[model samples]
Target: MTTILLLASLATLGYAAWYLILCSVSPWERCRRCHGARSHRTAIGTRRDCPRCDGTGIRVRIGRRLLDYIRTEYRAGSQ
Candidate 1:
């Protein structure tokens, strides 16, 4: 039981570290809706910019957004 708990905790820690590094290195990821094409095709074959990413083809990672929010909150609290 203890071994399983230790392993789970270690896995969680490793994933967190990896995600932090990822957010630091590449905070943006391809938009799921546009698949990095920046636009989507309508049923009639017309193309429109992706609404989610605003045609940027990428969006900020959730982890990075969370980090930014936390940093902003900390700064506001400190001041």
Candidate 2:
């Protein structure tokens, strides 16, 4: 009983840490390949938008959509 509960708590905490490492509520990291330029030079001597960043030069983390939803709900409740 007590032992089981302790194991469960530790498991939960481990899972939470793993989740945080695997995901992020906010992603502000710039695209390394494009260096935030949103465009790069091609082998053909032509410039093209970065495919990895979809020309945005920024990537959204997995949990950002959830954070946006929560923020919207909080704002609605506050108002």
Best by lDDT: 1
Tens-digit lDDT string for candidate 2 (1-79): 9999999999999997776665563456688889889999999989999999999998765566566688899999999
What tens-digit string does per-residue lDDT give for candidate 1 at 1-79?
A: 9999999999999999999999989999999999999999989999999999999999999999999999999999999
**Candidate lDDT values, in order:** 0.97, 0.82
Q: Any residue pairs clashing in model 2, and if so which? A: none
lDDT of 2 at 51: 97
Question: Global CA lDDT of candidate 1, please?
Answer: 0.97
Q: Per model, how many backbone clashes are there? A: 0, 0
Show model 2 residue runs off by greater than 4 Å: 1-25, 61-79
How does each model score on TM-score?
Answer: 0.93, 0.45
How far is 55's C-alpha from truth in model 1 (Å)? Answer: 0.8
